[model samples]
Target: MDLDAEFKLDDDLCYLNHAAVAPWPLRSMQAVERFARENAMRGAAHYPRWMEVENTLRENLARLINAPSPRDIALVKSTSEALSFVAYGLHWEPGDEIVISDQEFPSNRIVWESLADQGVTVRVVSLDGDDCEDDLIDAFNNNTRLLAISSVQYGTGLRMNLDKLGAACKAAKVLFCVDAIQSLGALPLDVEKSQIDFTMADGHKWLLGPEGLGVFYVRPALRESLKLHEFGWHMIANRGDYRQTTWQVAPDATRFECGSPNTMGAHAFQASTELLLEIGIDKVEALVLNRVELLERELNKIQGIEILSSRDRQRQSGILTFRVAHQDSQALYRDLMSRNVICASRGGGARFSPHCYTPDAVIHTAVERLAECIS
Candidate 1:
């Protein structure tokens, strides 16, 4: 597929902030427009077709995450909502502990912290400084019930060794959950291989879709462990039978989707997911890594700069963060934005996250623009 033609971004803007939000592919845009037109013209007459799209989305999500079954995927409004479901749904005993990385985005941190009201201890594991893995592992104790960490740290782009962490969590009998918002689309994720009990990611960032739609994956055996926190007709097994009084919540992951679905978002994201699948995840990862390496190499050539992200491939993903020696980070960010060099303020510096489809010219332009701003 012609990714450049598919996106059709403006020539003046160098969009390097796919980590924040991405421009939709042409197919996704077309899908959304068609859905809107159908809604306007035919109303709900073809609602069943829309439902098929939603199911297709679930299947694609399952494939993307390598979940054992599509029944383990739940369509949610956002990653925060999915995290909240896991946070509040579990019955925590007093003195029970949850371990998480100190560098987590607020969404991952705050949800676990909220459990303090129930006497649950929230342990913040520092992934910075010395011995990151040991520090996190040391935090686990007899009372540790869960270890929640992002597959890729949002700001610094430090990719965790999920397989190793999963093995440790399993040995300790603690539930392992991954916040995959930053890693899902840029890298391949395997729930079974990683032994992830739960995972969630919003489609807007790496998936190249829009906001207000996310994929939630819950392991089949663990599905029964989480208490149902939300309820609606759609969550019931007898959802189609409007007159049926006796109803039972779905036994699978569908129980987490407790209300009307986001059909529009589903339609757009399904198209987006299809495009990614067509390209293959391994190729996507290689392309993303190549761009990140190029960005890092170019950034290193500039004087008075510090690379904040990991240089090691095992610890790196799509994000490449850096800071100028004497210039204020925010000022640099503003200068880049004004010059149409799209980036983000993150990791106490500027974050330039380019995807597989990001043109090499855009990367060069971003570097030159940052140099100009600093000079």
Candidate 2:
């Protein structure tokens, strides 16, 4: 398939900031437009069709993460909401510990830290060592109740060995939670194979969808263990029965979703995920890695450019962050943005994250623009 035709990026712009928010594919844009038109004309006349799209989105997310069942997936507003569900749902004892990497995004870090009032200690392990996984595993002890980590560090784009951490968590009888925003669509993620107890990711990044929509996966057995923090008619087992007086919380992951769904966002994200599935995630991953490799190779050739992201092939991700030796990162980021080479300042440098559909010309132009800025 000609993937380039699927993306409708402008000719003068070079968008390489997929790690942040990504431009939607043509199909996704069309889907949103259709949804809007339907709402404008027919109102809720086609509501059943909208529900079907939502179900399809759940299935798509289940397939993307290799989730055990669609019942395990919950459509959430953002990764932060999903993390909040896991954080506030759990009953924390005083002195209980939650292990996390020092490199986590504020969403992952702040949630666990917020439990401090309950005397829960948040152990922040550094990922700077050669044996990073081992360091994280060593931080867990008998008092450790959970290990919360980002599948890929947002700043440095360092991909963690989830399988290794999951195995250790299993052996230690500790719960494992993964913030998968960075790698969800760009790479393969299997909850069962990795032995992850919980995982969440927003669709805006590598998934190539809109913001305000994400998926939360909770393992089947542990669903009941998490106390419900939110309650509503939608989360009840008798969801559509308005007259029913007594109700029970949903047995599945839907229990986490207490209110109305983001139907519009669901339609757009579903279309985006369908496009990814049609292209095949394995193929998408390969193409994305190729683009990142190209950026790394060309960026390394420029004098005084320092690649802050890991060069170790196993740890590399779609994000390639680097800084010029004598240049200010923020100033350089502004220069790049001014030149229409869309990117972000992160990890103490400028971060370029290209998607599979990004054209070769855009990559070359971005690199050339960077070289010019530095020169």
Candidate 3:
């Protein structure tokens, strides 16, 4: 398949910020168009087909994360909403503490920190200098009720050893939660082997869908532990039985989904995920890593650039960040953007995150353009 055709980006611009918001595949665009057209022509006449699309999305997400069943998936509005579901859903006491990395995106940190008013404590673990993987495991204690971390650090693109962390969480009896926004589509994830208690990701980044929709995965055993914070008709077990005065929460992960689904997001994400499945996660991972390696080598050769991303293959992903020796990172970010080299300023430098579909010429051009701009 021609991946370039899949994205159909403008010929004049090169998008290297998949770590931020990504452009949806052409297939996704077509899907959304069809969905909109159907809605205009025949409203609820095709609701059954829409539900089927939603089911397809759940199945695709389950396969992506290696969840045993589609019933474990809960479609939510955003990563923040999903994190909130877990943070507020649980009952916490004065001394209960949650463990998290210092490098976490605010979505992961803010939710847990908000619990401070409830007499819960949030411990921020620094993952910068020391061996971060081991330190994360060591941070856990008897007071630790849960450990929330990003699968990949947003700014530095540090890929954590989820297997090791999962094992530690299992042995320590602490709940394991992963903020998978950065790594979901770029890397292969297995919730079962990783022993993750909860996981969530917005489709706008690596999944190449829109901003509003995200997926939340909760382990089967821990589902009942979280007290429901949001409630609506859709969350009821007998969703269609409106006449029945008495109601019970849905038994599966759907309980987290309180109201009407974002059918638009569902249509778009379903299309995006189908392309990822066709390309295969392993292949995508390999392609992305290769591009990142090329970027690193090119950036290293530049006179003023300093590569900020980890050199360790096991601890790296698609993000390649670098700072100019004498120029301010923000200044360089502005210069690059002004010149049409689309990127972001992150981890104290400008971050360029390309996907498997990014053309090699675009990578070479970006590096060359930076050299010229900096010089």
20-108, model 1: which lDDT tens digit per residue? 99999999999999999999999999999999998888899899999988888998888999999999988999999999998999999
Model 3 Cα lDDT, one tens digit per residue, 267-288: 9999999999999999999999
Per-model CA lDDT versus the true structure: 0.91, 0.94, 0.92
RMSD of each: 0.9, 0.7, 0.9
Q: Model 1: residues >4 Å from true position, as ranges?
A: 129-131
Task: Give the higher-lDDT candidate: 1 or 3.
Answer: 3
Task: State the TM-score for model 2.
Answer: 0.99
Q: Give per-residue CA lDDT, model 2, range 277-318, as digits (tens).
A: 998899998899899999998898899999999998899889
TM-score of each: 0.98, 0.99, 0.98
Number of the predicted model whose lDDT against the real structure is largest:
2
User: What value does the lDDT take at residue 244 in candidate 1?
Assistant: 94
**Clashing residue pairs, candidate 1?**
none
